[model samples]
Target: MKYRLFGILAVLFFLAWQTLDGMVEGDWGRLEGGLANLSIFFKESMWPPNWSVLEARSYPVCEQDIEFFCSVGYLGMMETLKIAFVSTILGFIGAICLSSLAARNLMPLYISLPVRIFLSGVRSLPSLIWAILFVIVIGFGPLSGVLAMTFYTVGYLGKLQYEVFEGMPSEPLEAGRAMGLSKPSIVANIVIPENGNHLLSQLMFMFEYNVRHGTVIGIVGAGGIGYYISTYLKFLQYDKVFALLLLIFVVVVIIDLLSLMVRSFVNEEGDVRKPTWLNTLLKAKRSKASLVESE
Candidate 1:
């Protein structure tokens, strides 16, 4: 019976995959003919990069404008970081609250289903579209970026946290209630601690995701490194565009490495060696006054 079920599933998977593949191929056929036009397009606009800006030749094409772009580029990136970090913090908190209510063992279908639908709606809209909406509502610049990042973070974290909640054990939850603990108390003492690492890991993951989203949101005038890169491309400043690409790559790689460290710290809590300073912060803050008062 198991073998038959597996064979049927495998055949269905293959057919479904091919059906989607054929649909994509049909669309690609329409664009494939125009693919060669890119070469012709580039040939018509021969824009050489200002590589000499680093040294001689005195590439004096809009020195003031270049300076402004460089400054604004960094500022825009900083604004993006601000938006991403702030949105992630608020969104992660909101997700936790929603997840507690979304968990099947914890909440009713009427509640969880609506929340799930809401999250789907949030994630369904592309970041660019979100930015456009925000621009209409909040006006342009970093405000739009913040709103877009906020929704994205909510969708991503709520989806992830709900999964964590679903995987949670029932034994402790039942035991807590048997002991007459309130639901909130049970969640705080049992669920939150048990899933702290997972929550933090998701927060970090969302941080990285929103960082990339920040850069892209700026293309819609939401403000980020993309603003500079796009402007440079508009003016045919290939070198500046290339510089933005390199810088974004480095920033993303660094953030990825930081995320890996955070994940390792969370997952390897039992195996990690002791630290002097970094480890001290993780030690639960205990008040001597409380201990003395209790004594």
Candidate 2:
């Protein structure tokens, strides 16, 4: 069994390596100076990131007492965050409505199939394409970003939600059915509560995804930090772009921490014991250790 597994993995690895070599046209020598070139480029053009993006623009005439509030970083990041939040909410609601209709356990095959197809159609187009389409229709702004992300969120989340519904234990659903509960009532009182953890998880994940993609859409004049990043790129201002990139990294990390905190409320751990600030701040391993000790 072990030898068979090793052979399968070896074959997969060989295939992947051969495919990569073919794509590169076997020009393996081209990688010799890659590290040195990257090092030189970074030191010469990207080191010592410019901090001016954190201060109010000269032409903006900063009215706020705190100049940071008027800074490009703050304004742009806030706009991106707003777009992400709005889209995540709208998408979650839309996805729930559709997913309830599409789940095989909840609906007949004929009913579920069409809804599933519709979701697939929505999900087929990447968010970037949706952003471009909306940009053309609305002439570019945060609104365009929101609509694009919202559409994508519906498609992605709908699939996840219906699968969660179908995978749930059959007992509660059967009990609900025996009680002559309406489909809406069963969904509202049973399916959602049972899958609250997963739903919240997907919601948080989509919000983070949208926030990151906001930068991409902004490049096409959709509005956000990406617009400014695009401007800096046009002028070859790598230092400013690097600084903005760092800001985005920090924001994404913060969002991840927030996701952990939010999901803690609905997850199994929450049922075992109420979440505490200490648990939220602790590493997962340490939290598990503490939980074990406490128990």
- Best-fitting candidate, scored by lDDT: 2
Q: Against the true structure, what is each candidate's TM-score?
A: 0.72, 0.95
**Which lDDT values do the candidates have, in the order given?**
0.73, 0.92
Q: Which candidate leads the pack in TM-score?
A: 2
Per-residue CA lDDT of model 2 for 234-277, tens digit only, reads 99999999999999999999999899988988877788767776
Poorly placed runs, candidate 2 (over 4 Å): 288-295
TM-score of 2: 0.95
Mind giving the per-residue lDDT tens digits that candidate 1 earns over 112-185?
88888888888788877888899888887787888888877787788888889789999998899899998788
lDDT of 2 at 80: 91
RMSD of 2: 1.7
